[model samples]
Each structure stands twice: as C-alpha cells, then as structure tokens.
Target: MPKKLKLILINSSILLIGIILIELCFGGWFSSSNQLSNLGIIKDAKFEFDVRNLYATKKQSITYTRDKFGLRGISTYNQPEKIKILTVGGSTTDQRYLDDSQTWQEILEKTYRDNGKEMYISNAGVDGQSTYGHLKSTEIWFPKIEKLQPEIILFYIGINDFYRVNSDAKYDDIQQMESGGFVSQIKDKSVLYNAYRKLKGIQKATKFEVGHRKINFSRTPYTQEEIVNEKLLEIYDKKNLTAFKSRVKKLIVYAKSVNATPIFITQPTLTYRIRNGVVYGTEATKYLEEKYAYNGVGYYKLLSKLNDAITEVAGKKYVINLSNEEDWNIMDFYDYYHNTPIGAKKIGEKIYQNLTELGFVK
Candidate 1:
C-alpha cells in the first residue's frame, strides 16, 4: 500500500469512528434531553414555552411542554400503538396558551378512554402553519414518528390558510423556520451539535416565558356597512383556492398511503357569529372590528370559500363542517377561533360525536 494513500484511509476511519462515538455518547444524551431523538431528528426546540395573551383562559404562565416526540400534547412514547388518531392544524390545534390536558386532542383521548375505546389523539399542530406546512409534515414530521401509523388524521384547517390567501405576511414556513437540508439533517443526527443548539435555544426561549401578552388596539367597531362593505357575498383568490385543493388531496392521499383515513374538519371561527348587520359583539370579540380592517365580512366570506373547497376536494363523506354547527358561541372561544378549556371539551365531544356518526371511531 502506498504510504500517502494508507495514511488518508486511516485518518478517514479515525474521523468516522470519532464522529460515531460523539453521536452515540453525546448526541444520544443531547437528543433525548432536548426531545429530538427516537427519530434521528433534531428540532429547534425548548423544554418549555410560555405565552400570556390577555385572551388566554388564565392569567398564569402557559407551559408548552416538549413531549417525547418533540411535539405538543401528551407523550405516547410508551403507548405509540394507541395513537391511532391525530389532529393537525395551526395555533387552534396547537393551543399553546391552553393547558396540555385542556387541548381538544387530550380531551378526545380521555373521552375515548371513558367510553372504553382506547384511541389516543396525537396533537400534531404547529402555530402559524398553513396547508403548505401541513402538507410538508406528510413528508417531514408525521412520517418520522417510528412504529406509529395513525388510523385517522383529522385536519382542523382553514383559518391559517385564510391568512395566506389574500395576505402577504412573511410568517411561518417549514423551509424558512424549520430544520431541513443536508447540513440540517447532519446536525439533527449529531448529539454534540444538538446539545450546543439546545443550550442556545433554552437561553432565548426563557425570554418568551415572562410578561403579560396584551393585545391593545383602538376599540373601534366597524359599522354593519363597513363590516359587509363588499358587494360580493362570495369572493376568493382563484389561485389560492386551487393550491389549497391540491394540498388537501395530497394530504388525503398521503394518509391513505400510510393506511390512515384523512378527515377534513372545516374550521369554525368567530366570523360564524357575524350574522346580523348590527354585529354587536361581546367585549372579547370587540377587537375583531379593529383586527380585520375594511373587509372584515369579506374575510369571513373567503374562509367559507376555502372550507367549501375542502369539502369539494375531500368530498362530503370525509368532512366535519364546523361552520354548519351553531351550538358554539364566542363564549366557547378565547379569541377569534382559539378554544378555551370549556371550548376544547365541547369541540372534543363534538368531534367524537361526528366520528361515531361517520363510523370512524367505535
């Protein structure tokens, strides 16, 4: 063997072995501690997060815990087999402000256990994510959970997708905000790297835990004329509608590919209460007039259009049209759409009822 070539091979082998050792020893500890292991994936995550919005159900600090899979909701590490159903969407689904046990997914799981059915609903929601992010999870997030194939994937969609359609807010996207790419994959697999990153995250994450989350806006009530100023009762961007349909179908196909059923839960909103021209809202919702400028009613109209598209694409058999349900009022919600604990219970119960009616859950 040539001396130079032999030296290169020996050095390469040493480097590889050292890296593997670092991963097994340091990376293993780091990933497990940071809630990024069991999938060979590292997420930019903290052990806990706190949010304090004036609209939060309680004034206390909201603790968003890191479950075993690095996602929100209860840990299924010991009982992954029982996690047959999952609810995915945006903040409404994540409900960072709500207590862990107060989320609808938790409620649903408890309800099932109460009924002698032992199905667990893994909460796979992310804040500020849209249909684009949800579809991305079909490949990135959900599939990574080893030994788990959800039987039913419930989509609490529409509201976040609504933010994307007519607006150009530079918000959350998996590529822009989440981990990916070659370097990212390598880091995700590296225990030492994960330990360094998690330490940095914990430092910054603490900043979010303190203080009151107060939303202060001019208390201006848009008149009925201003609320429904649009001449068109139905209006939506065609391109947005098309893209939304494609994503929903793709998600459905991906769920079926994993031998799981995809059920589209049409999102309910405070807009559902905008029935009268007067539109006298409660104090909690008085902010909506200021929240939606100029075309508030038109915004509701667009959300309906998107929900309709969901039904059209997924078919009526696979949809839970929450817009059609009138039993809930502003009291059920903390803000525009995010549910309170009481609201979460009602929603969980309602979903269970729908699932039973549709025979998705026994």
Candidate 2:
C-alpha cells in the first residue's frame, strides 16, 4: 500500500462519511422545504409547505396553499359527502396567484356553502399543461379522484392547445418528453438537480412581469379593408386541431367512464379583436400572420375554430363558451391568456352560473 494511495483512500472515506451524515440529518428537510421534489411529477404530488404560504409570480403575489394531494386549493380529502367538483386546466385553473378564498373553485365552494349546499372543489391545474398533459394527468389522477366520487368534473382548457399547436409540438412528442426516462429518474434524486431547480426559481423571482397591463395603441391602425398576412390560418392546422379534439374527447370519455359529468370550456384570450376588418392583435397574433400561411385566415379565426372543435366534441350542453364573452379584456388577463384574480372570479362565477343553468348542479 503506497502512502499516497492510503492518504487518498482515507480522505475519500472521510468525505463520503460527511456526506452521508449531512444527508441523513438534513436531506429530508431540504428536499421537503424546497418543494421541488415533485415539481414536474404531478401525480399524487404534495406541496412542501402548509396553508397560507406566500407564492409570488411575475404576474401577481398571493397566499397559496395546496391540499395534501398536491392539488392547489384546500384539501377536502377528509370531507366525504360534499359534492366534489374537481376543476382542471392549465395555469388559468391553477390560479396560484390568487388566494385560496379568491380562486373560482374556492369561490364556488363558498357560494354553494352559503346557499346551504355542501360542496368541495379541488383544483388540478398545472402551469403550462396542455390537453396532452391533461390526458395523461387524468389517466393518473382520475382514479384517485374517483375515490372521492366527484359529481362534476369541470375542464377549463383550450388556449394551451392552441399554444401547443402553434409551438409546432405534437401531443405524443410532449408526452414522451415529459415521461421521464432512466436518466431523468436518476437525475430527479440527485442533490445537484435540486440545486439547479432552486437556481431557476431564484432567476424567476427576480424577473417577474406584472399583470398584462393594457397596451395603449396611439390610434386604430388597421382599417376594415387593410391587408393582413395570410399565414394566420396556419396557426390552427388540421393535424393539431384533430389531436386537440381527440384528446378532449378522450377526457370526456374518461370522465363519463367514472360517471363524472364532464364540462368543457372554450378559453377566452386577448388575442381576439376586430379592427376595421383587420384581425390585428398582440405580437403573438401578428407573429402568426407573418410566420405561417394558412389559407389567409386570421388569428382569432383560428382560435374560433379550436373553440368550435371543443364545442362540437363536447356538445353545446356541456361546453362553457367564454370565447364570445365580452367581459374578458386586458384587465382580466395577466398575460396573453392566463387570468388575473378578477378574471378568475368572473370565470368561476360563470362556470357556476352555467352549471346551475344547465341543471348539472342543484
């Protein structure tokens, strides 16, 4: 045994012992506190902290909480017999920037309770999740929710589908990418992975964009007869629209299979506007016009087509058509699509109103 080799072995043994002790003493606490353990893994995931934790994003700041199931909003896991309404969607449904009481699901629950009806709502929204993500999540979380035996399963989805199609990504491809492989599994358990996530979080914290304030245009630029790019039609291609519709249909089928009434919503966005017959909109809207050619269609036209597909697949009775609703404006939105707390309240109220009007909820 060379003296140099002995020294190296001794130092390595000491380092390993130190790491083991640190992990044994603090790894659980660190991971649990970081709350990034299951950040991407949504199934049966729980937030690291308890109720009333303040979570601030680029748009707004609000006290956020997660149920024991990791779903946003308060946990009603113990409350059996409450008419459970599981609301699902992308970041809009997530509404993490809104306090638990201000969320539409919470507002709905409170409204029902105030009216002497027992109701519980769980939010199953994930940021950036599209129909592709929803389909997979429903597969994983549907049965778990079935145990709760929810009466109405509300889906506030659509805009993300458009975003996905526009991004030139396929649902199947996204599913595969998100489905962690062997390497991801190993990386997920690494301390370095947690550190990287924390770093990203810090970066996000520093660069938060406030709610989508109104963009003041000096004057109406495009007239009714102005010429616009023809590529806007390509935003909603038949291929992506078919995929979106198919996934939505599958969601409805899955809900019905569990005997849960499924409700589809045509998401509203600031992307729609009519100016002198010119369908001009935000940068994204203009980007579609210049980037892709789709039979000379407009951006809003593509959104309408997607909305129509949702309504066609879900049927009129079960679909909440907010696309044509006049209330959603720049004030209601925090970005191109996600809603402000006010917007969330209006949406929540609308859902409640529609549900009652349709006699889905008594």
Candidate 3:
C-alpha cells in the first residue's frame, strides 16, 4: 500500500474502534430537546405531519389541530345529555398525526352514538408524558376536564416510563448515563460514526439470524453494554412502582369521588415481528431495540411490571390489557407506541367493548 493510504486506514480503524468503545460505555446517551415536554399546555397549535414508508416508500401527510386545551379532538367542554369521558395518556393517546375524526376517542364517541347513546369524550393526551406527567396533569389539566363532569377517566401509560428510565435520574439515579459530551455530539453528527454503528448493528443481526432468530429491522444488537443492570431494574421498580401505585390510587379515588368510574389502560408497543408464519423478534420492533431491552430487563418487562401494579391497585375489573393484542400489525404503528389510525380505531373498539361488558356504559 502507498504510505499515505496506509496511514489513513490506520487512523480510520482507530477512530472506529474508539467510537464503538464509547457507545458501549455510554449506551443510552441520546440528544433530546427540552421542548419535547409539550405536556398539557400550548393551546391552538397546528401541526403538519409527514412520513414516508420504509418499504413501500410512499410519502404521506396529515394535518392536526389542537384545541385550546392542547388536545387532539373538539374543544368543547359541555354537553348536557352526553356521557362525559376523559382519555389521558402520552403520544399514543395524543396522536398528533391523525385528523380529528380518526382518533380512537372520536371513534368511541361515534360508536356510542350508533348504539343510541351520546358521549362527549375528550382527549387529554400529551406528547412524552409518563405516569409522573399524568399525575401532574391531575393538578394542572384535570381540574379543567373535571368541569365536564367526566363520567369515566381512562389512563394509558408505560412507554414513556420505560424510556425515561434511561435518562431520568428519578428512575435509577444513573446521572452518568447521559455522558454525551463534546466528543459524543461530534460522533452524533458524523457520517462515519453512524456508518460504523450501522455496520455493527448488521453484524449483530446476522448473528441473531444464524442463531435462528431471523429478525432484523433497524435494531441494535444486544450486548452487555446495552442491558440495563439487573440491580438498577430492581431499584427502579421499587421506587417507581410505589409511585405508580400511589398515583393510580389517587386517580381512582378522585374519579370515584366525582361519581366517575376510573378505567386504567395498559400501553402497548409493536415489540415483535413475524416472518413466514414464525415468530421472529422481540421488544421495540422499530427503533433501537437495545435501549428497550435495557440489558436483560426488556422494555416490555418494565411496562408489564407497571401494568401489573395498575391491575393490582385498580383491580382486574377496571383494567384493560392492550399491550399484547394479536391482531395489531407493524403497519398500524408509526413508532414504538404511537399508532396509525388503524391502531387507534382498534384500541377504541376494544375499550368500547370492555366498557359495555363491565356495565360502565350501555
């Protein structure tokens, strides 16, 4: 090789190795904006949403309008003859991509009307909210919603809690986790670093395939670096689980005090993929799977633990498990938890069915 070319190759090799080491040591570090917390505020915002499919690769656009309450549906607060229902959750429930008529909350309203009943269901979902945010909403937004005298309050939670576990100090005190300094930022912007990560990811996928896993989609392969420590999971569960239980209790108690029945909904994600009629993969079938895997404590596991806490505290009769529905497909999801219109309608119908079966509604 020419002397200059040899030197260039050596430097590139060192850089690649260095970035991989950094990624391993500081796995969950990501660049996030403070503006991501547009929770229960920011009235009358209009959003133009667009996305292109990865496979079919077609561009799609949808316009969304938020009412004065920063929710996705009609902005009215009063209806005399209609049963008032309030839906609370994160982005999945917020659903900023769909039109007003496409939301599951709106679908539920129409479903009730078809059954000869009227419902004024309000969507109170906000982006990036967790149980902590939901609890805070009770003070910030719920009072406003309470004016409608909501006969039922629905809580959909878990995905954000699972994600915040990585960066939020409240979950595990892993303050060192967000150690993306100057070099890290550089790596994020560098084309070379991204290429290296992709190559490494492909290698991991190949290994999974060789091991008969037969699944790959834009996921980072699991290594010890990606696994959230078992001890951390235990500690996180201990602290957050208690807080989750207390928050659910508060929501339920407050709902009952107003003669409103409280229903807790478990958040679900597309965590698995099937190919050729065989089960192929696991948690976070979309983005970086390693983060959701959290070492060995999978995202679904954390969510399940939180859901279990809800069911135990709220009782089985008032809880609905939508996390592992068999009929949901990848095309129904735009991301981990946020859904396309189809998924929203599915959840809406399921909740409607449950409400009737439990006699919470006619």
Candidate 4:
C-alpha cells in the first residue's frame, strides 16, 4: 500500500472515532438526563436541576409552572405572617411520587388549618440527599426560614446517609451539601475513562459494536439487605454514626438557640416489612455483598447500636422513630429507596402525631 493511502486511512479512522464519541455524549446514550426529562416527573426535574446547578453558588430560582408529580402551589413567603414549619429530608421527605400538594409538608399545613391552627410549611427537601444535605440545608436556608420565624423544624433522613457513607462519590461536606458548588474529587485525566463511558452510551443507543465484542446492560447484581447492612456497619465502625449523631445534636441545639423546636424523624425504608429479605442488586450489589454481610439479627443489632448513639445524643423526646411500626409495603416504594405518595402521607401523619406529643401543635 502507498504511504499516502495508509495515512489517509488512519486519519479517517481517527475522525470516525471522534465522531462516535461526540455522538454518544450528546445523544442521551451516555447520560440519563434526556431520557429522564421525557418522564416529566418532579423527581426527574429535581435531579436534572441539581445536576445543572451542581457547581452554582447562588440559589437557582424556580417557578411553579406545573405539577409533574401533583405538587400544589401554596402561598409563598410573600403571604401574611403565620406559624412556619420547615421540613427537611431526602426523597421520601421530598415526596418524589407525590405532587406538591400531596407532600407531607402540604398535608401538615392543611392539617394545621383544619384544626384551626394557621401555619405555613415550607418544603426544603431535596432528592438524592443525605444527612449531610439536611445539615447543609439548615445552614444555608435556616435563616430564610428564620426570617419567617418558623416555630418548628422537621428532619426526615437516614437512607441517603446510609448509602453515601459507603459509596465512592465525593459529595460536598455538610457545610456545602446544599450550596450547588459541587466539585468532584476524582481527576478527569484518563482518556480510557472518558472513552469507556462514551462507548457504553453509544452501545446502548446504536446497539452496534464498533470494537467491543459485546455490550452489557444489566442492573448491578446485589441484594438491598446486604447493601444496607454493609453501609450501616461502615457508618458504625468508621465513627460516621457518631459524627451523624453529633450533627443531629448540634442541629437541635442550633434550633433551640433560634427558639425553634427541632424534631428528628427516623425515615422509613422499603424493607421494613421484609426485614429478612434482600433489598438491592445489580452492579451496585457487588459493593454490598463484598463489604457487609449481615443476617436479620445482625441487621437489627446494628440498628440498635446506632439507635443507642442517637438516643444518647438526641434523647428519646426529640427523636421520632417512624420506622418502628409503620405500615410499609413493597408497592409503597418506586425502587429500593424511595416511598410512594401514600407512604409519605403515612410518614407525615406519624410526624404530626410526634409533633403533637412534643407540643409543637395542639
């Protein structure tokens, strides 16, 4: 073959590869954003919004134009003075499956009105968040809530913390968890890393192999019980559980300092009923199966240990154990992590009962 011909062939091949990479990245093959947007779910919007503003510092103002998940547009902070309740949590507290009106925050507000108590509840919940996120929200937005002079602050968390304590993702510290100033600790230098991700997306889209023999698209094979138990133990032994307990204690103290009652609600999980069954699997399952293997007794044992730590720091009065005897079912969850609208309603009711007992309301 002539040298010129060989050179031309090599250049063409490189151009083809570059074109494929660009197509993969932009074609919704490499990321779920495009596909998820089509679903028109609030959770999806929240996730996409967070990703877009991951590195932003200022509050991204969002208007309530429509309900992707049945959320209602109650009076914003512009309304007349009223008793204010600030609720914080991950997806469950966020009520991903429920519309804004169906959320427990709204439910609690309506409940207050029904009983002749006038109050305004602000939903400060975010999806895919953790205890760190809750702490971040309190730090950044507590003042905004304080401007309203909120009488109570409700915190529903735990599941995300349980997952994040073991995952590889380096999210913001508690201080900046809600700030949108996200920066990955992992360096983006590996050509292979970028190429692998791009190629994976292309394979999913075109279903054609350019170089690789086969493409694998399967759920991470692992059980939920294993993942939870592993993460739970990691939090315990690494003293993360202690750190978390301390953070909760500090949050409560801070709330008291501001003259706002702080109430901690232990968010429920889907496996509440099937305590003996597995909860997760897929590629993500390998992390759990390899790290933490716990039986039913072992699982509850870890919970007891963590509960002791929390009890020691938070006292029984401030802590609301909503997971203890809740009527949870598999159908209540969209996945292994989040709860349905009805499930969140039950959780909201439990929280209301706890608030009543704590004298936050009549």
Candidate 5:
C-alpha cells in the first residue's frame, strides 16, 4: 500500500459518506414541513381560528393535510368508495402538531400497506371536540361525505370530555367531514421532489407568513409531586355519565347505520409520568388547575372516570381503553393531552395491534 494510494482511498471513503449524509438529510429521509393550518386545520364556519391558537410555536417541517372529506392522510381521490376505518376524537386524534407522516392514523395506514394489505383509514379528529361533537358529526358531518363511509369507526374518546365532568365547558365544535382529492406529500418516495418541497417550506416559514406569529413550544415539565396532593378526585358525576353514555350510544347507533362497528377507545392524558418501571397515575401540569377546580391528579382521575363510563356504557368489548392499559412517558405529549411524534408512533402501533387482535383489521 503506497502512502499516496492509501491517502486517496481514505479521502474517497470520506467523500462518499458525506454525500450519503447530504442525500439522507436533504432527501425525504429527514426533510419535513409543518403544513399550513389552512391545508388541514379544519376551519368550520363557526371556528374563528387564529393559527397561533391551534399549533405549537415551534413549527417544524412536518406535512399535515386533510382531504375534502376532512380526513387526514392521503386524499379520498385515491381511496375506495367505502373506506375501512375512521378514527374520531379531539386534538389527540386530530394530532394537529404531528405531520401526516407521523399521525397515528397515517402510521396505522402505512402498517397495513406494508403488510400487503390495503386498508384506508381516515382521521376525523378535531381539536377540543368530545363525544358531544361526535354526536354532532354523526348528524351534520359524516353524513355529508360522499360514499366515504368506513367499516370501523374508532371513537378515541375521554380526554376532552374529562373537562365536562365537574365543570361546564362547551367542548364541541368540529368541521363537517369532507371527501375528495389528496395525495400524501408527507412521505414522498422521490428525494428530488422532497428537496424542492423543503426549499419552498423554508421560504414559507420564514418570509411567507404574515398572519401567524412563531411561538415556541412550552419547555416546562411537570412532576407527579407537583401535581398530586394525596387527595383523590371525585368520580365523574352521574349526570355527566348519563350524558356521556347517551353520546356514546348515539355514536354507536350512527356507526351501525353506516354498517360500521364503533369502537370506543379511551385516550390517555399527559397527566402522569412513567419512571423506573413504575407508573404514576395522577400527574399533569399545575396550570390545569386554572381551567378546572382540580389539579393534574384530579384531571387524570376524572378523565379515567369518563373513560370508565364509556367502557361501562358501550361495553368493554367495544373499547380499547388506552387510559388504563397503556403507559407513556411525559415525552409522549406536548402538554396534558396531545401526542408528540414519538408518542403518536407508540399509539398508532398499539391501536393497530389491538385492531388486528380484535379482528377489526384482517
């Protein structure tokens, strides 16, 4: 091995590695964009949206889009007349902060696609909606989407309804469902196309926006000690339970009307933390106390009660109560009730597995 020859080979290897890294980073592998809320943020005639109000300040290059049917992920222009699954819920299900590639709905969609299965799953999540909103959806929204009925309607309930337990919050307002054209730009296979999108996104984020202000994500982290104070929260009131039960039943009825099976899934809150293999049940931000009479501990407990109501009302066989079954670290959520990408992946995978086990997805 001559000295000059050895040096040339080493330099060539370094160059090759550099090229690959650039391709991966600038390629679709690492490129992403925070889609404008206009693309999927669900602005009903009733929603007086301030973009600042709907998303985290620290926007990333994550793509989020909704079809005319208001379903997240790929547009219905590419879907079958009868979609297989539709997940309904509030912000947790809407997953506004997550890119289309990262939302649990899309994650579920990809899983089926990868397994030689072609199942179309749409996300019908709206921020701040509850069972009440879903009932409204059955009436005003879902009926409008043309030939877009799903076989399984996953009702990811509990979190937003938790507020209505002891307090009076009109947690209902979601856009009417829409169905139409959309192709997923999130995980495009062409690296060149991805690169072009990234450049445009950079421009959009920097100089293109005048109506939106850049707000950073809240960095404050909560601890179980800070949120829980030994006193237990009261079970959700019987009146609320009755109302909640009625709502769930309505959703079920709506599902049956569409020949869809309604499965009530209990969504977990960011109220608790997981540490050292032990799970802490009641824990969330102290700021929650401002909105509700109780702290995070109470919020967690109350939400669980609402969860129990759904299970008890809808029957456990039709519910996947992630609130009681899953354990996620604080990192799973940006706040008390929304998922980060990491959190979304865990959730999406879990739901897919549950559906498979339950024979909802073959």
Candidate 6:
C-alpha cells in the first residue's frame, strides 16, 4: 500500500473511533440503560408514547379541566354574585397528586355551594414555591385577583420557607440576583438546550424516574412527623426567626392593602407515634438522616419559630392552626410535607368553617 494512503486510512479509523466515543458520552447513548432501569421498561423496547407531545402541549381552558401544571379548573371572570376565595401556596396548595375535584380548594368551593351560598375559588398555587415566591406571585397576579375581587386570600406556606431559610440555597431578590453557575450555564447553552428541547419528553420522564429512584435510595429512617417535632426544633434561633417574622408581617400588610382578608393556614406534616413501646421517626426525618445526616431537631425548631412569627403577625383571628388539632392527623400527609386529597379536604373544611364564623362566607 502507498505510505500516504495507509496514513489516510489510519487517520480515518481514529476519527471514526473518536466520533463513536463522543456519541457514547455526551450524546446520551450510555444513559439509556440507567433510564430504562429507572422506568422499569423492557430493554431494547421502543417507547410507544410521545412524551414530548404529552408534556409540551399548552392547556387551553381552566374550567372543569386540569392544566399541564396539575392545577384544577379555570379562572373565570365576571361570575355571578358570590363570595370569592383565592388560595395561594406551594405544592400542598397545588395538590399535585390529587385531581382537580379532589383538591381542598375545590372541596371548599363545593361545600360553600352545597350550603346554598354562591362562591368562586381560584387556585393560585405553584409547586416548588417559597414564601417569597408567593409574595412575588401575588404582586404579579393580584390584578387578576382584583378583577375577580376575591373576598378572601388564603395562604398556606412555611415548609418551603423553612427549607430555604436554613439551607445554603440562593434566592433571587429584585435588588440582587445571582448569576447561574457553570453547570447551569452549560445546560442553558443553545445547542444543548435545542437538542434536549427536541427530546424533552423522553428526557423529562427519564429525569423524573431517575429523581424518584435517587430520592427512594436516599430515604431516611425518620418520618416527617419526627423531624417536625424534633429535628426542626433544633435549628430555631433569633436571627432567622426575626427574618421570617418580618416577611410574614410584610405579607399581612400586602394582603390587607388589597382589601382581601388574609387567612394564614399552618399546613401539616407527617407525624410519629410510640408503638410497641418504641418511638418511630417520620419518613422525612429518616430520609434526611440517611442521605445527609441532617439534624431534624434543627428544622423543627425553625418551624416553631415560623409558627410563632405567623401567630404574631396574624394575631388570633387570621392565623389558623391546622397542625394543632388531633382531628387533622399528621398521617394524612402524603409524603414528608404534602397533604393527601383527604387531608386537603379536611383542611378545606376547616377553612370553610372558620370563614363562616368570621363572616367571610355566608
């Protein structure tokens, strides 16, 4: 063979190998096994569902329907005369696992209507939100609520606030926002973003299952209830407590300025009990300790401080202590922090009852 021809052939072979290696690494070829295993799908089986089509489609109407974001019903304008209620909170208020009909907001709306009182309720809950997020949302969406002229604004928050307040997570305030880090920058790259955008459905489902697997593997022995009373208590201090209080106060003043009665509900968490002469921690506590050896007592203390602050801001009339009552069991919680449909219904009923007493509802 000619020396130049031989060298060309060798270079081509090396180039082919390099291309194959690149395809295997960042091209997601090597990620298939892990994705399939997480999905519990058969190896080499072609996926039938178009996950992109499923998730990417925009919802048209809100009435009597669920949105891609898992929110129930629609926002209606110029409804017949009835008491209007607006719910604002995080995932618990969003009711991700529950259908539109099963959410507490829906339950409360139905109850009010059943009792011969006309009412309209709008759910302004978003998942993975914090107190600051709620405040921001209110600032943005208050005009929409104003159009409806809701009589009451019910806010269910604290868990996410507690998490963010104690953790090293950076928040983006209007005054000072942090720029994305290196990994975030790469993920935001146009080429990579476009590629993932093309395959977003499969990517999202794969990512979801992977996340669930990771969380399951990282489970701790303690339940959420145990962490609430124990681990959450240990982290309580004056500084964070004061900050939390100031936020609550700001929220109260904001709510009042809108001429909408502000009702704060202290949502519930999973609880533990002494069984067989042994004490068991809640799942959240167990998961936290097993994965990060996190101090549950600290979190509990923080919650205590938050509750205290809420009470101070709301006074006796506005703050609703849902967690304090035995009728509202801690076991009703779906996970470490969120409530099941049944739990949400219970909360909704309590809120309805309170509103009736306060003349917010007839």
Please report, as a residue range, the 10-residue window in candidate 4 with the lowest summed lDDT: 208-217
Candidate 2 lDDT over 238-319, as tens digits, reads 4667667777788898788868899987777665544344454543223331345322124456677888888889989988
Q: How do the predictions measure up, each by TM-score?
A: 0.66, 0.67, 0.65, 0.58, 0.64, 0.59
- How many clashes would you count in candidate 6? 32
Superior by TM-score: candidate 3 or candidate 6:
3
Which whole-number lDDT from 0 to 100 does residue 220 have in model 4? 20
Q: Cα deviation of 221 in candidate 2 (Å)?
A: 8.2
lDDT assessment of candidate 6: 0.54
Clash total of candidate 4 = 19
Give a tens-digit lDDT track for model 4, residues 144-242.
332455577777766555433443224324333323432321112223343463464354323211111111223223343433455557556675565
Candidate 3: residue 348 Cα off by (Å):
1.1
> Which has the greatest lDDT?
1
For candidate 1, the per-residue lDDT at 4 reads 100
> What's the alpha carbon RMSD for model 4?
11.8
Candidates 1 and 4 compared by lDDT, better number: 1
The parts of candidate 1 lying over 4 Å away from their true place are 1-59, 75-79, 166-237, 272-294
lDDT per residue as tens, model 1, 1-362? 99999999999999999988867665534444432342223243444344444454454655556455546557463355667787788778877677777788888888888899877677778665678767756665666667777788899998766644233323223343344566655544566665564464344323321122332223424333334323222224445576677778878888889898889897775544545433323232212212433244555556678899998999888998776575666557655566767778888888888888888875
Q: Stretches of candidate 2 above 4 Å error?
A: 1-61, 75-83, 144-146, 171-237, 273-280, 283-285, 288-290, 293-297
- Residues 125-243 of candidate 3 have per-residue lDDT tens digits of 87556666675566545565334566888988766665443334343222211344576444334444545644653564353331112122356332222334465577557666766
